[model samples]
Target: MADTAAEAEEKFIAEAKTRVSFVRQTGDALSRDTTVTQLVERMITHLRATVDDPDSPVRPQTIDRYENTVAILRGDYAGGKYPTIGDYPLSEVTEDLVHEWLWDVSVIGPSMGAQCRSAMLRAFDLAKDRGVRLWPVNPAKEAKLKRAPRHIARALTVEERERIIGNVTAWQTPRKRTDLLSIVRMLADTGMRPGEALALRWEDVDLTGAKATVTVSGTVVELKGKRADGKGIRRQPFGKSDAAYRTLTLSSEATTRLLERRVSASSYLVFPNDVGGVLSLRNIGTRWRKARGAEFDGVTLYDLRRTVATELDRKYGPAAAAAQLGHTSPAITGRHYIERATVVGDFTDALGTLR
Candidate 1:
């Protein structure tokens, strides 16, 4: 697998398996049924070139996802994995082929394998429209992916959260890098994503009236650049879904901190660099790592959101927790954000019973 290795290559398939597994129909020529039209049709072409509708163009993210799925399914183009699979006729493709390919990908993780399966289904739907009916049913649809153990959101204790923020508070004004700590606190207070916190503006925050709320309307998204996709930045609503664009009630701590650090009307972004430009997420992360050091290695900005979400779940229940986190469903929040380790019963009642 590499330049130097001490171990033998682990073989997945047995040499003398009774049932047929992977069949390489190399150099197989398609029967000339409709001259030029039949020769050009392929899964790769539909994914890369074919437009979904006359009016609505395919989303750029869709293209990126399909390309990745194609790489995993058909393998590399310039010779690697199983390059020849791309050339296989849509009519020749089968469920067994997709299952085996996805099985290979499952080694990475179940989520990845599941996503690949869905991508293949989309590609094959294009094939269906093209009249390339392999079997009576769509082959890609048959591929099943079992759910693996997913990593739940990591939450910090109240002391851990305070201690980290306390460290950040030491750095004073005019110092630009110290802004990372403020952003960290904002994430904890509002449960806004790191990018959302970075993309925040002074106008979005309301420091007056009976209630203080920050309108989380936009987030920093990296779209398709000149080189590749998902590279450029833009302040856009609905970074992931319609639910992402939401208004969150700022905690008293958050309100106080934000009020102190509110920039002038001339500057728009709440957390800008020295030149009033947006600070990059990576740079902020580096500062956070240094602030936490070895004591909080695994904790992240998302974990700060997790901490807030856990408290939300405790106080208000799942619905409130989901709304605050901009989750479309309570299930996602319930699955990831809700901490399972703590006791849930009435503590006062339990104390009385203990007495």
Candidate 2:
């Protein structure tokens, strides 16, 4: 009787182990079969990271923009079918869906569509990286944009730059507007973004140095328009690439101008608002609009950045231009920011000479 009981007990244990093994196999299968919704949720969660910069989290403005792309996929702003692309199966999602979505948003504007497509492509690529098998291929790879979207085409002419400076200088007041004229001039000369220029501390400027240097590290921005995570931070953190941190040597003319325009602000910013808050983009825009008086369509403070890019590209080629602009790759400066080939003289003369 004892031997029979032991044999029964051993058999029962073996059966239980078999059942556990089967359950484990089932779980492995289930894990591999993650749904499309699960994959995208993973993608979204993963993207909420500091990919933009190493110093801090992704800039809030950028997060909002990324979220907007998700919204675009969901048929939010820039209308498309409800229960949109996100509702579909992962393997089932085709290039056609991406192309269609791009086309759908194009009705709103090419720029909006381009931004949406670009964002979606990034997410999809991320999903593939996470072992999701989210797509056999990135559909966006084949989806060609029919026409290039209109971008900022022209740099500010010297006369236009002078006029903007003159206007800003004439329109300033103790409270209404302050120090914007000097900031504009600095941007043109040094290729600093307005935000970078505004965030500059007096200590960061070395007027005493033989080559006047402005450290291009910090950026100032109002928090209201950006993502929640970006709020409460006084200065927008620098984005990825160590190249963003560098010393920019100012021209003799720029150095002289900076010294003349420098002020002792309580905020210690080289350029500050009347009350010494970082000069906001909103304030700058309001003042520029009023100063220009006419429809100076397409002219903005950022154009000054482009103006500097054009000058650098002209003087030193794209690689040197990229270095001055603090880009790790010259391709970015050459492709996006720097203006291509100046039309110096009549091509007809060159052609005749060649003949």
Best by TM-score: 1
Q: What is the TM-score of each candidate against the true structure?
A: 0.72, 0.71
Residues 149-244, model 1: lDDT tens digits = 877776788899888887666543455544677777788888888888888888888889576888887677554454244255555544466798
lDDT of 2: 0.66
Off by over 4 Å in 1: 1-59, 73-84, 146-148, 169-178, 227-231, 342-355
Candidate 1: give its CA RMSD in angstroms: 13.7
Q: Could you tell me which 10 consecutive residues in candidate 1 have the lowest summed lDDT? A: 18-27
- Tell me which residue pairs clash in candidate 1: none
TM-score of 1: 0.72
Name the runs in model 2 displaced over 4 angstroms.
1-42, 49-60, 78-83, 125-131, 150-152, 221-234, 239-241, 260-263, 329-331, 334-355
Error of 2 at 278 (Å): 3.2
lDDT of the candidates, in the order given: 0.65, 0.66
Best by lDDT: 2
